[model samples]
Target: LVIDEIKGRDLRETLIAFGEHLMGAYMSPALIGVYRTVVAEANRYPTLGRTFYENGPARATGRLAEVLEAAEARGEIDADDCFRAASHFVGMIRDNLHLQVVLGLRPPPDADEARIAVLSAVDVFLNGVASHR
Candidate 1:
């Protein structure tokens, strides 16, 4: 669903959409609970961690990498490694806000906060990767 929305969009648009999806997922209490549970039980069932990584973060990173590869091909960005770039972008999107939420240090960001965070991340990421030409 999210991947379909990001596909064919320009780099900035794709990143914004992906960031929105990350914010939505991170803000969900149910999803957070599941993540906590997964972490807590992962040591006992190592496959649980691998399964979560493959199904969640790995899938998201792969989809983002495809979009990034397209952007590089079109000269919208200058990434020699789309997968690595995608991982960095995803990290920026997650940021410390996700950590705060996961640790119960703070509630999930409000919509306005999330928007600001996403936009900021997009700007910084583009500054680093945007095509000079």
Candidate 2:
């Protein structure tokens, strides 16, 4: 879903779309409840965590890695490890905001807030990985 939204876009645009998708997913109450349940039961059911990771985060990361690989081929970025880069990008998008939301310390970001967060992350990430020449 997210990969389809981000595919064929330029690096900045791709990151923006990706970030927005992540923010939407993270903000979903149903998903939050499911994640909380999964976390709370993870110790008792070890396979739950692995299952969640494989089905959710792992799939997202794999798709993002494909996007990053395409960006590298296009000379938009210079990533030696697309999968690691994809993970880093996801981490950056989540940041402290996601932690705060997950902990119930704050409400989910509004659209403007999400945009600002995503753009900031995209800029920083682009600066780090953009092709030197």
TM-score of every model versus the real structure: 0.91, 0.90
lDDT tens readout by residue for model 2, 1-133: 6577667778788888887888788777777788888999999999999999899888888888999999898888888999999999888887898778878999888989988998998888888656779
Leading candidate by lDDT: 1
Per-residue lDDT tens digits of candidate 1, residues 1-133? 4677667777888799888887788779998898999999999999999999899888889988988888888889889899998888889888999889999999999999999999999998889656779
Candidate 1 residues lying further than 4 Å off, grouped into runs, are: 129-133
The TM-score, computed over Cα atoms with residue i paired to residue i, of candidate 2 is: 0.90
Q: Scored by CA lDDT, what does every candidate get? A: 0.87, 0.85
Clashing pairs in 1: none
Name the weakest run of 10 consecutive residues (lDDT summed) in model 1: 1-10
What candidate 2 gets wrong by more than 4 Å, as runs, is 129-133
- The TM-score of candidate 1 is 0.91
